[model samples]
Target: QKEVEQDPGPLSVPEGAIVSLNCTYSNSAFQYFMWYRQYSRKGPELLMYTYSSGNKEDGRFTAQVDKSSKYISLFIRDSQPSDSATYLCAMSEASWGKLQFGAGTQVVVTP
Candidate 1:
């Protein structure tokens, strides 16, 4: 089984709408979950991160993890056109260099 899996969606949303993204993992050893946003032809930048199981919210972004279910999610509220980008879910098993990544989901926020 793949360690991590995410729907690579070209998810389209209107401006000011809420966007939801999710990922799942089969490995119970994963302790760190992270979400990253990348613009076309650019490097990914970290958006949110959670340690183990819990929910974290920052501004319009919320990151949630369910260790028992091996699932994670990211929610963006009041999304803007500038938020259009590729979102990637990644996890690590207590090793910084050994992160498992999912296929990035592309988001387009239309004005």
Candidate 2:
């Protein structure tokens, strides 16, 4: 299996829907969990970062990590067309920097 796996989704939903994106990783050595949002042709922007397992929330986004299951998730609340983008899950050993990423999930929020 690949080190990380995520459905490269073109998951389409109407405005105001809640969106959930997830990934699974095979490496237990990964110490940092992260989510990134990327627009077409743009570098990803960091969405969230968590160490080990637990939950972290910010504005419209929430990130969850389950180390026992080797899984992680990102939830978007009150989704909007402006939120259309690719969501990427990443993990790394260093808390200060760099990440290994999933292929990314593409999302479209329509009016």
Cα RMSD for predicted model 2 = 1.1
Compared with the true structure, what per-residue lDDT tens digits does model 2 show for residues 50-73? Answer: 999999999999999999999999
Model 1 worst lDDT window (10 residues): 91-100
> Per-residue lDDT of 1-111 in model 1, one digit per residue for the tens?
678899898999999999999999998999999999999999999999889999999999999999999999999999999999999999999857588999989999999
TM-score to native of every candidate shown: 0.96, 0.95
Q: For every model in order, what is the number of clashing pairs? A: 0, 0
Q: In model 2, which residue pairs have backbone atoms overlapping below 3 Å? A: none
The TM-score leader among the candidates is 1
lDDT of 2 at 53: 93
- Model 1, stretches more than 4 Å misplaced? 95-97
